[model samples]
Target: MWIVLMAESYDRLKKRAQNRRSDAEEAAKYIFDIPEDMLSDLSDDDDDNDPDFLSPEDLDDVDANTEPSDDYSVETPPSSHQQQPEPTASTGKSKKKLKVQEKFGWRKVEIKKVDLSWKGEPRQVPGILETPLKYFQKFFDDELLELIVEQSNLFALQTEGCNLCLTVEELKVFMSIILLLGVIKVPYYRMHWEAATRYPKISDKMGRQRFAKIKRFLHFNDNSKAKKSGEQGFDKLYKIRPVLGHIRSKFLEVTPEENHSIDEQMILSRGEAA
Candidate 1:
């Protein structure tokens, strides 16, 4: 247990082993580089009393503060007369920080994050969600539009608030004129659409509340299971989305003779995850 507690981690041990191997190789290279003359100069026959060697009297100042060693190797303490000057506060701190940086060898790196914030321009790349909505103009067929109006009017009558009590035929006429107003602009606002139809202008002529009611309650697919099972994500699109999946499946089933390019798109928004 004690040995296990004191044992170094695998990474530390591997690093230490690599360092030892590198140091040994470096020392071997240095030893091989040494000339024969330098090795021969270190003879054991040299006398301590030789005039060329340093005498005890000459080392009296150095040895005064240090104890005499048993071996021939001399260990001299730093001399009091040759003491280094005390470093200033600023200089000491700078020198210490520099030394720490060099020893650890860590570089300060700055990483800039991707700016996903929509700029409403070419600045940020645009996707299907971010681009101008062109669904109404692109896939709005007469049959689909008529069915949407019929179903929406039925839902509006059943809904508690923002109800549009118009019949299927009246709603069809209303939707047709309203859609035409997109292409042919008129200053009459809601009355422009009402006057184009045979319906009387006695009631509210397609007001904002009725418009919102149609938008909220509109459905193309059966969502009874989805509503009961608490479905989410693309399943929620079933409530308000047309039969777009069937259209996609039809296109997939057919083989194209011509080649076309399609761009990839991602929907990114507040609290919306893909």
Candidate 2:
């Protein structure tokens, strides 16, 4: 009787152990066998807050059964954050749908070539392309030089209470020295007149002191008659207005060929060019 009772207890224990193991295995299978839609929802919930994360729709998954069309086409999916445009009543189509349906059609057309030959005169004013000085003087004539002299002398008298008596010939020499300095650059204007680095062409034509005085008193327009800054009739380039006007008049007189181009690279410095 004792042996039978012990065997019955042993069998009950074994049965309980098998039942617990079976329950555990079934629970594990239930966890792994979740529905596809439920798994997708869980994944979307996890990534909804993440902006950088791409949703399933953004991915291009071509169907294996689909065949290629004769016309090449690509449809890009809109971002998750982008709002959908409302459909218009007249067209019965949304702007996005219209954009997707838009096609670029090409058709055969006839084109004609036109002649582009020069018919105008070779030279507007027939004259020899002579010396450089003559070419320069053609633009900066005696009239322009006289105007400079008059203005400079008048400015000197007004400011210094003394006659500058600036002649056109002297003004021309002063201008020549200025142009020469641009070509043969030095650290300072005084260096050109210095004994160690004396340029005779500049120093011999005009003394350093005289050049400085002329430069100081030089004017293109009357200061008293000019409007001040913030005034009603103020001109930004008032001081150089007369000079600019004269130069512009001269520029208007010039006639170029049909294919003429003005190269402005020469005026720009290295810093400006960059």
Candidate 3:
């Protein structure tokens, strides 16, 4: 009796499961049907006569890939812009497309020059030295000039190879040769300098090597011992700082007349170089 009861219960469960599956499948399946009123304007008397038009019964098999009805119509309001299609679309296609145009507008900005005139009285510097010769003396006095010579000798000694090896007297002769070179048009051939020049009274000439040595090691001041101003980008000529300072002082000391003049000219066939 118990076995029979179990069999009956199993059958009831199977029947219940089948009913639930049917309910779920019915929920998933849907259909959208257009109301006759909405498609009223799409109706045509000639639709029945159209060769490719299908009846409502045939529409139920639309999922089977039925061809679209040639007489299918949508209600589009008449627009004047719609043009008559050309013969190309008589083979059945949309021949025309509409295009929209875009426009751009730009606004320009103004630019003005920056002002650079002085705002107030310029800061003044205190005067120190007087004459240009005195300024030159301040940097190249007897003791400093002697030191310059000695330093040059030390450098010549340390010079690589045997170049410019010279005694003190030879160095003096070299300095003399360089001094005459400023006023003489003699090219730096050793024989040209040592040769008898136009001025026979002038005495003593040296070889070019000594002169070249002096030129190489010559400096207005000892570069290693030079001082620096605290300002950034401050570049006074390192070799000629003393002379520059003196020249600057000479200008600062001058009390120019209210009426000033400026002149620029060439001397001895040289303009900018001169």
Residue range 133-230, candidate 1, lDDT tens digits: 25442344456666666566556555554555545555554565566557666565444436464233422455545654555676554433345445
lDDT of 1 at 207: 55
Give the higher-lDDT candidate: 1 or 3: 3
Q: What tens-digit string does per-residue lDDT give for candidate 2 at 193-239? A: 99999999999999999999898888888888998889999998888
**lDDT for each residue of candidate 3 in 1-274, tens digit (9 for 90 to 100):** 9788667866765676677643322222211234545445444545777889986668877857776677987778745466544333333465544443433457796878888565555545548647865654554445545555665655555554334444455545555555565676555444354555433322336445545666787644555564578756555676666556655665776554434487765346644564
Q: What is the lDDT of residue 180 in candidate 3?
A: 61
Model 2 stretches with alpha carbons more than 4 Å out = 1-119, 124-127, 265-274
Winner on lDDT between 1 and 2 is: 2
Measured with C-alpha atoms, the lDDT of residue 43 in candidate 2 is 44
Worst 10-residue lDDT window for candidate 2 reads 22-31
Maximum-TM-score candidate: 2
User: What clash count goes with each model?
Assistant: 0, 0, 0
Model 2 pairs whose backbones collide: none
What TM-score, to 2 decimals, does candidate 2 have? 0.54
CA RMSD for every model?
24.4, 18.6, 30.5
Question: Of the candidates numbered 1 and 3, which has the greater TM-score value?
Answer: 3
* lDDT (C-alpha, whole model) for all candidates: 0.52, 0.78, 0.55
Model 1 / residue 168 / CA error / Å: 8.7
